[model samples]
Structures are given as C-alpha cells and as structure tokens.
Target: MVHGRKFISVLTLTVLVLGPGAWAGTETGMKGALADIPADVMGFVCVPSAKALDEKVNKLMQQLGLAQFMPTSLLTLVKEQTGVGDALDEAGSLALIVYEPASPSPDELHNAAVILLPTANAAQLLESLKAGEETDGVRPLSFFGRDQFAFSKGGHVYIGASKATLKKVAASEKDITSRLDPASLGHLQTLDLAVWVDAQKLVKLVKPFIDQLQEMAKAQAQGSGAGSFTAIQLRSMTRSINMLTEGLESAQIGVSLTPKGLGVSFLMATRAGTKMCELVEASPSTDKSLMVGLPADKFIVAGGQIMQAEATKESITDLDALFEAEELKQHCDVQQLGTIRDSIREMLLALRGASFSISALPESPEGLVGLTVVSKVVDGQKWMDNLAKVVAACKKVTQKEEVAKALELVKHEAGAATVEGTKVDRLSFDLAAFTEMEEKEVEEMKKVLGSDGVSVRLAAASPEHVVITFGGGEARMAEVLKLVKAGGSPLGEDAGIKKVSSSLPGKRYSEVYFAGDRLVALLSSIGKVTGNELPIRMAEVNAPVALVSSSQGPCCQVDVFVPMEMVVAIKDTVMQLMGAMMGGAKQTQDDTL
Candidate 1:
C-alpha cells in the first residue's frame, strides 16, 4: 500500500514462500553437495560429515567424568539457530569459505563468507531461520543471476563478508581448489590441522602495516604524547620488530592423536644468512642439560645456547680493539658503565650456553626453592678462571656501587666453599639476620641502595655449574651436592622421557617435561583445597606431555605429545572447578543481601 514496487515485493515473497517446498527435496539428493564448492577459496573450513563430528563429540562427553554438568539445552538451542538440524546425518559435505577481496580497504574492510551446503539443505537452512526475526530481512529471489538478486541455489548461503565473494564464485567455471598453488596445498595435505602460508606473500600482505606501526612507535618515542617513555624503549621496540621480521619462509605443522599423547610434528623455515639462521644453526640438538640433575618435584626448568652472549659480542665489530678495561664499563651500572650499551656488552662476555632448573628442597617442601645452572665449556677449569677474572674486575671498578646497592640488605662477604674437593667462590645472605638490623640503619643503607630488601645464597655448584638458592636453608656443599645429584626414579632416568629424548636428532639443547603423576597430583590437590571434589582422580589417567625444542636442518621445531583422554579429563576438571567457584561467589552475594 505504500511503495512504488508493491507488486514486486509480493512476487518476491511468493517465490521464497512457495519455492522452499520444491527445493527441500529428499535428503538423498544432498549427496556430493560438498564437492560442488568453488575451489578458489582464500580459506575454508570443511565438515565432510557433521553427523560424524557430532557423534564423536557426544561420545567424548559421555566419557567425561562430570558429564552431568554439561549444558545440553544450550547446545540444542545453538543447533537450531545455526540452521543445521539433526538432518545433518543425511547431509553431506558442508564448507564455509572466506574469499579474498579483489582489493584491500583503507578503513573497516568488509568481508564475506559463503556457507556451502547440499542443494537439499539450502532451503532447510533458510526455513529454519524463519522461526525468528532473522527471515524478516531476507532479500531473497531478487538476484540469483539477473537483477543483483539476494538468493541462489546450487547449495550456498551468502552471509557477511562472503556475499559478494560467493556471487563472483558462482560465475566462475573453475574453483579456488583447482587453481590454488600446489606448494601451499601440498604442505597442508601433510598435516591434520594443516596451515600453509607463503612467507613471501604474507610479508607483502602484512609488512606494510607493520612498517606503519613501527614509524608510529618511533614518532611517539620522539615526542611525549604517549606519557612516560624513553628513546631507549622506542629503540627496544624497533629491535623487537626487527626480530619479528627475521627468518620466516614457510612452515608446516601436523597434529595427530597417539597412544603416548596428542603428538604435533612441525617444520618451520627461516630466511638464510640472517642472525636467526646463524643462531638456529649453532643451537645444540638436545635440551638434556636442563634436566641433567633435575628432580621430579621441580616446577620450572629451561636450557638453551647462550645466543645472547654471542649477540652481545657481535653488536660491536673489531672486538679485540676494545681493551678489557673499556669492555668492563659496558655491562654494569649505567653510572658505572658510562653507557648502558657498555654494561650489556661486558655482561655478555661472561655468559655462555647453559641449562638450569628450579625445584623445591625435599626437606623444606615448598618453603625452600633451589636453582641449578650448568654451562657448557671446553675446559671447566679455564672457563672458571676467565669468569673469576671478569667478576674480580667488575668488583674493583665502575660496577661495584650497583652491586652494593642491590645486596644492601644482605650483608655481602666473599668466601670459598669446597665442592667435590674443588675450591669455588661463594656468596651468602642471611635474611634472618638482615631483618634484625635497626630501622634507622636500614633506611640509611637504603638511601644509598634501595627501599627494598632481598637476600640470596649463591655457590659455584661445580666448575661447570652454579647453584643459586632463594630459600633453600643451607647454601653450602651438602645442599648443592643434593641438587647436583638430579634425583633418581624420574628426571633423567624415566624410561618414557628417555625414549622421547633419544628420538630427537642432535645433542640436546633444551626441553620441558611434565611428570605425569606429579603434575596430576598437584592439580588434583587444588580441588581438595577448595573442598570441591572431582568425580574422578587424576591418578587414574596417567598421561604425560613432553615439549622438546630442537633444531632440524634450516628450521627449529618443538614437538609436544599428550594423550587425548588426558586433555578431556583436564578440561572437565577445570570446568567443574570454575562452576563451583562461580556458584560460591553468587551465594556469598546473596547472603550479604
């Protein structure tokens, strides 16, 4: 009654209302609908059989210990809203595609996705949406091929960024799949959760954006619009950007389920001749050193080549031109070094490739934490000698005031400790004694130092290793010896761990291993503390994941393995815990009212 095209509106409505029944045909007609999808796709996530995926999810839910807590009603609502009904059992291949834009937008780029379904389900998908206000906006029947129409058959629902992309794809004789770069698709074919990115193509796509941000960061650093910031900070950001830009060519990774755990095998390539390339080439093959003397009760452990040391030295050319005394100023107090760069440089000279770990002292439990650091050296004796010279030199000049300030609370004294019948330099701090000092006296020291107090016990654990204890009571030979003896039963001796370690190529550079039993017990204990009992105990599902980082050819790879069942159990426990916490919080508020 109102518009210029009332008849057209009526005609459009009739087509949608009347055409659906004819299109809904038999489910059998939906077969092979997935293959019809246009291959030329920027990105696509395919569900070959929704029924299979749904059933698997249901089976997994049943296997979960706290299946009762799952919100089934919510899932049912989602299925109804998404327009994929239980008829999915009869529905064949469904793919959602993200088509690349013909040109990039300067602001708020719009995109489109085409939801591909079986020809039979297109009508059902649209009809399912009719129950709500969703269908009210339908522009259907005005455009399939002639009048820039709103709807089309051949199994696709246009939405958001995919609207135009689908229209273009509809006219093409060949699809993206047929025309895609073989290099990209072949790499993806090798992986379960496959991803293939052409490094050069990605660089072109993203680097300009990064360059603009870098310039902005530099400009902000030069000005004061961003509040408290420094040129040094801006410079650091630039370095980070450079680091991000380095060594990326192509990467391929695969994920698969295994009896041992969820296994991931990945391959990443880095540009040649770059600093990262050199570092990767120099990196040792294994991370065994990190766990060399590790104990099962440890929390965090790490090991890797001393890339920083090399980088520090490499920052300056003609290294020998700078004498020992000049180099001393490079890595200590800014006031002491004259320049921060100098301080960083000197510190680098004494550091090298090493491995280390932190663990609770068996006797003191969590109260006492111990750290063991081991360094690789051609000659342990010579390495210690050079290190001693560096430390002694650092003490005599420029860097001492900074050291004194740092250890002001801890009365600093030089001593020697014998470990394995060898004399090694030692430093001790007694927190108990430090706290007893007069407030006035402490304040006076802090003026020259800082308004903070920290005490640590340090020892040269061995010629090639050092032990630094934050809370472990005795910092002497006996304690250090206990740590040096990486505990038995687990750690270096566990059969499963050893097997995984052995499988990695090259000498071990670094690794992170979680003891299955220990990790399970620790996590389960949290439930007990909160008085929220889990339906099942972690001990029943003993699965361990090992993260091994090592170098392979021109790339670096980290392989991780954990069991699927273990993953499910962990997820269930966490959800239950969160639910309990939320419920308790709500109850507290209710009681307050």
Candidate 2:
C-alpha cells in the first residue's frame, strides 16, 4: 500500500494479516479464486492463509487477558452474518479489496469484500451460504451481464459489490494477477510475509475522487463527519498525491521475518520519461562516501541524498501549473507566480545534488536536536556571491511577513573547519543574533531558543561542496567535520545494514541508522511513565535499525531492517503475560460464580 491512501480507506478496511504456515507445505489453490476477480481493482491485499493466522490468534486469545466470552460471542455473530464458521480454517488464501463504492461520496467512503477458502472447504462454505440464500441482502447476483454467470465456479466462489468496477478481466485471464500473483499469493516460500499494492490502479481510482472533493470544496459544506472536508486540506492532499504519483509507474511492498528481526521493503518504478527516474539514475552512491560529516555519537540519525536537477525541475513545473489553475488564482498574483517559477529553476540549477540529515542529540551541549540541509552547488563561492539576490527574488507575498523580521539582519558570516586534510569554509547564519532587535523581542527569543535560534550553518567541504546545518550546536561544525572524517562508518560497516542494502538495488542513494539500545531504553522509559507493568525487553537485545535505498533501472528500492529476535522476545513476553492474566481471570470467575 502507498501508506497514506491505504489509511484513507479506513472506513472500508478492518485488516487481519494471514499467517504463513498454511502457505507453506502445499501448492496454493488461491490462483483459482483470483481467476474469478476483476482486473482493475483499486486496492487489494492477499495473504497466505487464514487458518494458520486464526490458530495463532485463537491460542493467544486463550492465553491472554481479554474476556474470552466476548470473542466467542463475536465469532458466533460473524458465523451467522457470513455463514462461514470453520470454513475459514480451510482457506488457502485470504484477501480483501476496497474498490469503487456506490456513487455520491467516493472520497470519504468505500465498499469492500472477499469470502473464500480452499477448494474442498470452499464447497462446504458455499453450502453454508446457500442455506442462507433467502437471507436479506444475500440474493442472486450478476456482473456486467445479469444471470450470465454462476456464483461458484469450479471449487471457488465469487462475491462483489453490485456496482463493483471489476472491468472485464476475462480477456487478461492469463495475465490477470495483481502484483501478488494468485499462485504465489498464499506463498512467498522462503519469505515469512508479504504485502503488495497496484499503484497504477490506486492512482487511477483516486484521481476522480480528488476532483470531486475539489468541487465539493467550492460549495464547501458546513458539517464535520461527512461533507466537512476543507479545501486547504483537500488541495494539499491532492497536490501531495499528484506529486507522489508523478514519476511513479508501479509500486510494491513486502514484509518478511529474519533470524534477528524483520525486514520491510517498498519499491516503486518511475515512468521512463519522468525526471524523478533520471534523477535517481544520476544520484550518487552513499556506499563509497563513508563520512557525510555528521556528529560522531549515539544519536537517532536520518538523512537523504537527492539529485537536485530533476527534483527541482519537477517541483517547480508541477507547482507552477498547479497554482496556475483557474481555481487557485485567488491565492496569488501573476508577479508572485513568475518570481516563484524563476527562483525554483535557478535554485535547482545551482544545486547539483544535496544530502541533509536530522538527529536528536539528547545529551549534546550544542543542542538537543540538530538539522542540516546541505546542497552542493555547481560553483559554491559564485553561488554564495548571489545568494541574497537569488533567494530574495523567490519570496511570494504571503512569505514577506515571515521573512521581514530576518531581513533586517545580514544573513551570512564566515567560519572554517578542516576535514581530512581539506580546509573547508563555512558561512554561518545566526538569526538568533537578531532576536533582541526583533519587533516581538521576548517572543522572538523563545522561538529562536526553541528553534536553535534560527541558525543556518553551511560548511564548504571544498570549492564545489557545501554542508548546511539548520539549528544550534556550538560543536556542530566539529560534528560535521567528524562526520566527513568518519565517512559514516557506523552505518556503512554495520552487518545488518549491509545485509539489507544488498537485498535492495545496488546503487545506494540514501542511508539511515538508529541506535537500538537507546531506542529500547526510550521505549522502556515510556512504559514506566505510563505505569505499564510489562517493560519492553529491547534492552536485552542490541541491533541497529537501518534503512537504505538504491536506484535501479527506472525504479528504486527502500529496505527497512529490524531485528526479529527482539520481535520474538517481545512476543514471548506478551504471551506469558497474557497467560498469567488469563489464569487470574479464571480464578476471579470461579470466585464470582
């Protein structure tokens, strides 16, 4: 799933992940079921087996603290409603889909469904449903042609929303599979778990709904639950989706358990002609660039590497057209639009490729947090010469008030640092220096202190290279130099990170590393704060949380590596606690009755 829109379909999805045991040790029959589904599905999720998952969940429930009676009661209700009690136990694969809902309010609501099992068991389940054929809302159904097909074909069954847009998938029969092929849906074989999404279909399906939301915003209703979607939020979301789907041609996601932890991967392909793909292709590999000049300490670090040329071009062009739309004319004037367009192009042209990082130092004297957005210029000192003029031209009218206060102070001053035998010049912008003179002096002081006093620290690693740090840190430059000297050995040399990076595309574009011990301690402290009796057992295990991505072909790969041993330990602790609670519950019941 694309993360955002997947959650947006909240009303339609109540997820239950299928287990792996069922998929293993057999040739899956899920393909037969998939054959009956339509092609142009908006959202789809298929899991290996319902039976194995149910077994685990039920055992956990039996051992756990929650009331057992409620689950049983709910199970009975579900059996009655869907008419498939134990049939789920025999399912080869289980899946759900959120497709086109009935008309009127597509943006906020959706319709969904799936009911199936293995061939032998599916017959029994079909019989159960047939027995309740006269049940209200369970009537004879038809697709594009009424009475043209039977509900059960072969050993599988078919059920869909009446208005389901399963566009004539019969022709693509040989190729009618979502990213998760039907035969393999129940099995990733050696892999522990998987998740996939049809990005093209998702984008295709949502575009119309976004347009409708735009129209609704014009009359902009007056309620909260349904029609209350504000234009600003809608516009922003629309733009975001448009931006995301811009270069994207296809997408896939997967989750698998490793010996130490778990690994999750998200992959997306850009259309051949998109600038994003080109940028990805041209991006530098972080593997060789060990020292990015970040702080050498135990901090939660996040960073990215982007080719400026493509990103800037796309952003400027897209945003320019977006604002140029007749609907957004009220927000800006011709002059402002023209200024923004030129600034963006110029900025991108100056920016060759940039890498930036954000970290929570927790224990550092310079500041509790640090942020750096450093862009490499085609000609650093030359660009520095015209920085004020170039940036000043880009400010829209709405932004004037924001920058007016900072405008009074000169933005740049010089400093230098030596990194690995190279002397680097840095331009430091300490906006906090102007805090006392700011109109709202007292308030401005608080804001600056909170925001590291609005400091922008840039280190010119070389004539062509520049590192920009955005917050407070007296030793920030020291950290930057150390980062360059260390060359990010903490991540590049990490075994787990290396493993994950290898699985992804070979061209590493970006990397992030998290201290496992610190994170675990943080979690344990949080539990203590909330008075949670069960402390997370993470401290007992040490593993780095690493994410690295690489560009390959027209697409890129992002892999998240986390230790499975920690996950397993947590599971064991939870189940043990649940068993204790269940025993206590039983004693209480006996005492009561």
Candidate 3:
C-alpha cells in the first residue's frame, strides 16, 4: 500500500511537465529564430560537422543570387586573413553576416554582423549596436537591422555594416581577448572581429542542428516511429534522469506500457530517504474485488503468575509413590505417571512448605470438635492413601473385641469410657454420645422456648410460671426434663420412678416405663409423659456392596434410597442446633424473658 502511493506521485509529476501549457515560449522563440536562416544553411546546421558548415554556407549564397558578388574563393580568403577563430572560442560571440550591395566590391567589403548570444541577454547587445551609440564599443541592434545589408531575401531580415564598422565591433573582440587572456595579439590576429561574428552566426545556425539531434534521440527511443516519439523520449529520458538521481538512494522505479495507457510508480521510505518506483501498464481488471495486502512486524509475550497459584492449591504430596502403585495401572500410563507424579509432588511440597492455615469442621457434626491442619511437607499422594487406609482400619477396629475390651477397662476406671485412638483419631463413642446429648438438650430448649406462641406469650402471661405440657402431661415431662438437666441417669443407679411435678395443683403421681428409644414416666393425671415418641419414619441406608466373583473380578454397587426431605430437615436442624448451642450462654435472658 505504501509503495502504490509513491508510484502515483511520480506519474503525476510527469503528466504536469508534458501538459499543453509547458514550454510555449521556448517553442515560439526556436521557430522565429530558425526561419531567418536560409533553408540550405538550416539543412547544414542539422548535420553534425564543421565541413558541412562551409559547404552549406556556400550553397546558401549561391541560391540567394550572391554567388557572382561573393565568390567561394573570396569567402575563403576573408576567412583565412581574419583572426575569427579566437572570437568563436569565446562564449556566445558567434554571429551570421548579411551583405547588401548595388554592385560587387574589389576588397569584398563587409555588411552588418548579427551576433548570437548564449541567453536572452545577447538581444540587448544587438539592440544597442543598431542604435549606433558608441558606448564602450557595445551597441544594440534591431531584429530588422539585417535588412539594411540587402540580405533579407525571401522575407528573412539581414544586417548591413561597413568593413570599418565591422573592424570597430570590438565588444565581442574584447570578450574573446578577456576569455583567452593573451599578453599580445601577435600571431593570434587571424582570429579577428569578422571571424568572431561568423562563429556566433554559425552557433546560432547550430540551434536547428541541436533540435534535429534531439529528434534523432526521440526516434531512437521510439524505434523510429513518427507516433508520439517526442513524448515517449521525454518520458524515457526523464525516467532515466530520475532513476540516476533518486533510485541511487534505495529508490526504485518501474514503467509499464499497455494498449490503453502507460503507468509509472516509485516508493521511498519516509525516514531513510530510500525509494522504489514501479510502472505498470494496465486496463482495469475485469475482477472488481481483487485485493492488495501490506505486512508489518509484531511482537508478543507468554506465561504468567495466576496459573501457579491454582496448581498449588490442587496439588497433593507423595504423588510419585502413587504413580508407582499397581492400582493406578489401568487409569494412568506408566511412563507418564512418573512425570505427572513428580510435578504433583513438587507442587504439593511447595504448598505444604508454604506458611498457611486451614480450619475444617469435624466430619461428624455431633462432635463440637474442629480439625485444624497446619501446612507441612508430607508426600501428598501417600497422605491421601494413608488416610483412606486409616478410615478402613478404624472402621474395623471399632468392631474389634480388643478395642471393646480396652474401652470396658477405661469405663471401669473413669465410670465412662473415653479412649482416644490414633490412625483414625477419635474420642470414644460413649463420651461423644454424652456430650452430644447435653448439646442437644440445650438446643431443643432454645427452639421450644424462643417461639412466639410459647416463650413470648407464656412469659408475658406469667414470668415465673411453667406450662408443663407434653405428649404425656406433667409426670412424663418432668422425667424427660430430669434426664436433660442431669445429662443422663447416674451411671450405675437404677433411675427410680418419681413424680417430679403435676399440672393439677398439689396432685402427685408417677410410674416408670422404657418407651420408643427413650425412658419415660407415667402418671394418672398426666397420661404418658416422658417419651414424646418422635415422628421418625425409618429409611434404609444403603452402603456400597463390593462384590468379587470370577466372572466379574472386582465390582461394586450401592442399593440405597435416601429420604431427601429427611436429609434437608436434618441439615437445617443441625445448623439451628449448632447456632443455639454456641450462643446458649449469651441468650439466657432471651430464653427466659
């Protein structure tokens, strides 16, 4: 795209130069000047030699009927005697002579001398000479002054002057002397004023010759065709000139010629001054959608920090050993396993060594215990495998006779077992159960007492009053309340039936019974008080059944149907219970009031 823009600028410059208005004045001047020379002299000037100049001048004189007066011998004699060579050597001193005579002269008497100057400034000299003012030997002459010499034949103007005046025409003579800078005019006298004037005329005649030479150049460029040779040659020559001057600085140019038109283009760098040009001859392509493309350089970078953090969090330790384990054979490629393991192990090690802390709730919510593990360097995969093994081992140990025996001994000493085990570390189940029951009692009290229909309304009616209502009235409510307050019945004592309270003012009654997973008390006034018989529907908890048979080597399946509603209720209840238990001490006023 950049190259194309440059090409158009060059083409536009060429068009401007060749337009109709260009060179108008120069063309007019060339035509007017050349018309004054005789046709034969014009023809000689077109040739490329000095010998042709003499031959053409002689022919022109004969054709003008001056052959009888100005004989060839006389012309030769005049040329030899005068020091005209020096005048011609000087810049812009050459001129043509025209003579007017009623009859021929014995000494070949001279006429007006028409000097040709290099530039327009010479026209002033010619004008001064015609005015005949002796001002520093320079004079101005008119274009028509040559007619006074009787040499204006065929509508061409001529100049006339005497031999004395010609000798005194020292302006050009002085110019020649200055240019040569000779100490004396001794042997150099042959190169005199007349000779100088003649040389200037000869040079003026050579103008048409130079034009013809340019024409020849045009012909060569166009292969001698008359068709637009000048324009073609101008374009070719200008292109060559531009290439020589511009293309040397890494500038490139191209030209194309086609049946329809010609095109040229150039490209240059803005910063380096380097350029390129191309010319293509084209008719518009038939396809309208052709596209051009330009290309440039671009740079980019890869890899960042966030990815490292994510990798660390998910990593496990001892991943290398897991890679070597046989159990992973079907799931992972053995060769790549080592690599995967190493990377994971390194990541785990990084995470473990990092100074960080994490807190997690115990797997069993009944235990108000939390598990906190500090970051530590451990084989991550091995740790995970060992954890699984510990769970399986612990489950087995829980049912083992040895573990039961140890628990029995502890219970004998402490009145309750509270064994703490390692591997699958846990406090004894009995102690855990007791702790759970106590927490549950506090939670249930908050729930029942905090409700607006219960605590608020009842407390408003009587601040210290007790509305002891249960599924089985005052007697059963009293026993259940006792069990809650004392944590559990004394370890070895047979919990005696007793009437702790009755709704009927001073009436008291009691009966003992075990009911529906809870111990209960019965009274005559309060029917079945202790056990509320919670509305629970039994749900079959399906455990995964791992089966191994010869046909199906190792397969596992689960037969289970979980009560979705129960699970949701359990989760909500546990959350509420936990909140209440944690806040219980602080919320005592809220509960009672």
User: Lowest lDDT 10-mer window, candidate 1?
Assistant: 17-26
Q: Each prediction's Cα lDDT score? A: 0.46, 0.49, 0.26
Between candidates 2 and 3, name the one with more favorable TM-score: 2
**For each candidate, what TM-score against the reference?**
0.60, 0.60, 0.13
Of the candidates numbered 2 and 3, which has the greater lDDT value?
Answer: 2
Q: What's the lDDT for residue 144 in model 3?
A: 24
Candidate achieving the largest lDDT: 2
lDDT tens per residue, model 3, 1-593: 44343323322211221221110112223233333333221111111112223343455345434457654642244223331222221212123433222222322222322223222233342343344444333333333223121111222222333433333332122232232212111112211111111222333434466557666676674663323434444544644544334422111122211121122222221112322112111111111101001000010100001112332432242233334444445444454445455544553544322111111111221221111121222443344343334333333333346554443432211111111110112212243233445765544433332211111000000111111121211222233233323333221121111111110012101111111111111111012122354223222111111111000001111111112222333444455556767687568868888
Worst 10 residues of 3 by lDDT: 294-303
In candidate 1, what are the lDDT values of residues 249-368, reduced to their tens digit? 655554433233355656566667877667666665543445544444444333334434445454443232232232343544434233333433443455555545454343322233
lDDT of 1 at 183: 37
* Model 2 weakest lDDT span, ten residues long: 141-150
Quick one: ranking by lDDT, best first?
A: 2, 1, 3
